[model samples]
Target: MKSIIFIETTKSGSSREAIKTADRLGFYTVLFTERPNFMAKREEFPDVHFMKLCDLSDMNVLQKEVKALILKGIEVSAIVSYVDPHSYTACTLADHFNLNHFSTEGMKNIQNKIQSRELLKNSSVTPEYWTVVTKAECKELEPKIKNKFPLVMKSPKSTGSKDVYKVGNLIEYRKRYNTLSTLYENQPILIEEYLPEPQYLVEVVVHKGKVHIMAIIKQDIQYNRRFIVMGYKLLLNPGVRFSNGLMKAIKEIVAKHGLETGPCHLELRRKGNQWKLIEINARISGAGMNNMIKAAYGINLVEEMLKMALGNDPDLTPKFQKNVYMQYVTVEKKGTLEKVTGKRKALASQGVVEVYVKPRKGSVITPPLSMGHRYAYVTAVGNTAIEAEANAKKAAAEIQFWIKESPKEKITTVIQ
Candidate 1:
């Protein structure tokens, strides 16, 4: 039987769903992960035929294990990963096995923000950006960009809004620069012009150099210390002309980067009638994106991506159309979760199709520092975008978290 090898996957969401999808499609599922104990205990992945524990960060170990699997007569059909950190590794392994996959170089470019910005520097999509690699470079570049306040600083390896910051002035720039530089010492730091609100997520699938637009979802972002995407609303009827323009730009980006096949999602913002690209990932959007897409259009993006990885034609045709909204639930303060309430209420609310909460009674929780901080979400469908968003918000509001706040630090005075 043909087998599919999956790299490290998250505890939930589309990555985990992909494993289940492959099993349902009659493929022998093999998982390579570092956290076998965590995954082995989960009843969600009972169909996973084999689970191998190894250090995923080391490519040599992964290659050796794959070779061992082949020696054991495991028919490795395709190697794939849904997580960001291991995407390039999975693509490289796919090439070694002569499997159908995206360009490894393209995947690397997608993984590294600096390289991606350099590749698209001349394009109309990217923002004005600068890179700093050393302390001297940081100091030298500061004077040049001092006037360019409200710039966004990012570590090249940052993902999911982590290590990404918006600095409003020279002081804030210095502070954020110090923090990120210290955290990612010796790595290049990306500083770009901050793109304001009304962000959009464009999901694209490319097959043998042909680009297909799957969906365009408008994002509703909320700001605390970091920019948090509070909700996503699928645009069922984004004007034909507008979509055409987006498609053209996306095609250009894909062609320029040599991304001939597989899935990629682009984060974009409309600036004065022109769409500017924020970032692009060589994978589908994470979290409840697959669920939202399936709920709205009756298409399983994860399954489609898995089919593409296995050298099969993906069906992007929509079975139905409906406005869908996904609202993320977040906390306001740092604390130990004491109790959660109203999940039943949220699930029973009108138009709510799904409600998911992550934290348990004893789980520690905090305010949004990144996308990972979002503890729960509510997905709803309606006749229109407004109604969909309203329903999701109403349902999400019904779910509440009760927590025991962390104790404040005490200040001590030293007499001289």
Candidate 2:
């Protein structure tokens, strides 16, 4: 029997999708994770066997475990992971076991923003960028590169826009770097020219030197001093011209960057007539966006990626298409969630497929300043963009947030 292995699996919806897909395919799914109790918490997954690991970052430990398994006469057919920092580890293990996967070198190209830029240098998608180690280094190189203000600084190894900042001036830039310096210590930070709006993302899966283009996601991002991805909306009513242009741009960017094997998420910005690549990573889109993909196009990327990892050709063709949107739930205030009303109303509305609110009645909640702080997301579909968008918004707004505000500093009146 064929066996599939997933490393560093978190107790997330995406992780569930991957393991369940493997189980459905009749593959014996073995999951390695730091949280072994996650298995006991889950009632499903009768076929999934959970294994505990001491450290996910230590490749030596992981290598030893897999090697031991191999010596036991167990044949590991495929290896896969959905997380970012762990992607390279997955590739490394796959290479060691001679399993099918995107190469470790290619993983390096996209894992770091600076390295990804280096790989795409001299291409039409190339954007201005710089790397700095300390505050002094950033100050020294700030005025030297392109003389562009309002640049964006980001962590080279970051995921979900954590430690990412936008600086309007030199002072702000220096300050942001100084704050991040203490956290990152010696790691280099990537600073790049801020691309304007009309940002987009494309999901592509590559296998055996072949690139299969999936959906083209139109992003609605909120940028203050940082970027908070508000939504990934469907592309409805895109004329023939726009469709051809988007497809061409996506194809060119992936081919130029040499993205081969596994599923990759590509982001780009379209300014007037020109399209500039933002960044690309070898992973599935997160934040429940994968669910939206399934609802919109009847394509389960998690399932497809597993098949790809096993050297099987999964269907890339869209089974059907609909207007679908992933709308994030952001709190307006910080407090314990007293109550949430409007699920029946939201679900009762047209085009609303799913409404997932994060905060429980007694759980503490805060405004979504970054991806980590996002409260919940709702997925909706319709025949048109307006319908789907309206449905999602209506559903999200219907769920009222009644937070019992945290108590302020109390003063004693004994003096009177």
Candidate 3:
């Protein structure tokens, strides 16, 4: 039997869901991760093969390790990944095996914001961007920085808006730059034109060079010091005028990037008539959003990813069973996660499928600098966008992140 290789699963029980899908489709799972301590006993992972690597980030070493296994006559069917760190590995290994996959180099262009902007320099979608690697570079770029006042600063390679900030002037710029410099210690910092919000997340699945619009997610974003993605409401009928135009632009953009197969999650914003590009990730959205997509559209993006991985066709044809669905969640200020309130109330609400508050009592909480820090998640569905959003909102409002204060000195996070 052929084996499906996962560089690392994003979450437990096979991160990609591709693993389970592939397993059900008659394929074995080969997991390569740095966590040798995890499931130390072979019996703990039934029908799953595990391999240890000194460093999953060392591409050469990981490739060599896998090549050694291949040399031993192990038959593998496909390569798939869910997280960012291992995405390149999946692309590289798939390319090595001559499997249908996107370009690894193409992924690099977008992963590095500086390179991504360079690629789009001549395109209409390009934004004015510069890299500040040194303090001296910061001083030198002040003129252009001031010209494009209210600039957005971010790490060249980052997600969940970790160090992303908006600065109106030089002082604010210096403060953000210094904070980031202190955090990253000389890593490349990106400064781009601050695009207006009312942001949209487009989930696109590409197979055999064909692009499919799976779902256009609407996000309620809060950018007060921290870029917070509060929740999302799936727009079932984005309308022909919107869909046709957006799809055309996306198809052109994907073709421009030379993205081949698999899932690509795009962050978009429309300023007036123009659909501005925020960032494009060559993987599925993080934080179980795939489940939300399935709940709304009756399409499993992960399953599509699996099909594409195994050289099979995906059913992109829409089976739009329902109009709206949502996944609502929240993060908390610095404190210990005490008790959760209104969970039962939320669960009992109509159209609310489930409620989950991740942190247990005494679990410390911090500013949501990344997706993992999110406190809870609620999945809801309804016939209309308003109803779905209301259900999600009510459920979210019902649950509270009751936190007890921790010593301010104990918090070493910069977000504070």
Candidate 4:
């Protein structure tokens, strides 16, 4: 029998769900996670294996040890990484093993924000205005860019909404830029015209150059400094034309950019009757959004991505059971955890599937308004979209979080 090696850094939903998929795929799953305390849910399963990976970025060392493992009777057929940064190493390792995989060179186009914008703009999938910021360069290009109120400034290589900020005028822009420069130490930033409207998330799965629209997810986002997605629901019934002129445009762009395999998650917004592409991700969306799609639609995209990596034909079915929502219980603000109630009651409610809590009593939690700070998430599924939304909202409201005067930082992670 073959084996699957999952490459992950942190123990987020992606890490846990990767293990679950490995079990479903009937392969001996080996989890390579970052150093000490890589929460191995091995106790929940008898077949899966977990290994602490010290440094996955060191490709030369990793390749040598991986080759040795294969020689020592470990049948690792595919390497998988859902996280974007680790994707580079995953693709390189797969290439070294002569395994089917996405190109590391192509990953270069996705990891760097500037490159991705250029690619999208060239294909006409991007908005009209975009600028790159450096401590030495932003001032020179300021005059060229239209100083529209509520402009967005963000790190070129960031996920979630950690360093994303919206500024109204020059004073606010300079202040925010100074703060970020002090904190991030001169990382290149992206400045763009903000599109104020409802955002739609499109997840597409590809196998052997065939693209399948996996799900149309409606995002519920919170505006702190920038847009941070709190939760989402799979909109089975879309009023908007999903497969019209817009889809054809995106398909051509993806093909032109040579993103022929794997799963692609993109964010778009409808502004005054026109759809605009925001950004595209070469990997799975963070926060187990793909798993929610799997629960609603019978398409196991994680499994499909794995199958594609193994050079096997994937089952891309259009079968979908409507009315399901995936919600992540998020931290609202920085505070000391004093109370958490009604969890038991909410779990007992209909359509409430799972609850995963990271912070306990006395654990200081940061509100998820920013990508840098999110406590935990709650996921629920229902019979209809209304039922699903209602159930999730009920659960969210029922659970109360009491804060203390002074809170400490306990959980540290990116919003994604």
Clashing pairs in 4: 329-377, 329-378, 331-368, 333-367, 371-415
Q: Count the backbone clashes (under 3 Å) in each candidate.
A: 0, 0, 0, 5
lDDT for residue 162 in candidate 4, whole number 0-100: 70
lDDT of 2 by residue, 1-416 (tens): 46787885654456667887788888777777776566566564565764554577787888887777777766799878887677777888888778855766777667777777876777666677788996678778966753688788878777777788888787888788888887889989888888776888787777776766677778778865458787778775567877777667766766655666667888888767667777788788765766788887788989888777877788778888899977776665677877777777877877888776665689887665577666666789977887787778767766666777734422110110
Tens digit of lDDT per residue, candidate 4, span 1-416? Answer: 57877777345565456667777768877766665454545364444564645577788877776776688798988887887677767877888888746756666666667877777775455676556457556666566654576788877766777777887887777777786777767566677778888888888776556667778788888786667676787888675565564466567656755776777777888766456777777787766665576668767677677777777777878576857776566555577788676678767877876555556798777666564355545567777788887776676555656667533422222233
Lowest lDDT 10-residue stretch of candidate 2:
407-416
Q: In candidate 2, how many clashes are counted?
A: 0
Best by lDDT: 1
* Candidate achieving the largest TM-score: 1
Which residue runs does candidate 3 get wrong by more than 4 Å? Answer: 12-16, 35-53, 67-73, 338-345, 404-416
- Please identify which of the two predictions, 3 or 4, would achieve the higher TM-score against the true structure: 3
Please rank every candidate by TM-score, starting with the best: 1, 2, 3, 4
| lDDT of candidate 3 over 1-416, digit per residue (tens) | 57778777644322646666666777767878776655465465554655454577777876776676678787777777877767767887778778645667766555666766677778766566888889999999998778788889988767777778989899999999998898889798988888775889899887767888888988777666767777777887788888887887788778777777667888888766667788898788876577777777678777777877777788876666564555545554678776667789988988887666666788888777666667677778887877877777777677766666733322221211
Q: What residue pairs clash in candidate 2, if any at all?
A: none
Clashes of 3: 0
Question: Of models 1 and 4, which has the larger lDDT?
Answer: 1
Question: How high is the CA lDDT of each candidate model?
Answer: 0.85, 0.73, 0.73, 0.69
Give the deviation of candidate 2 from the true structure as CA RMSD.
5.6
Cα displacement (Å) at residue 248, model 4: 2.1
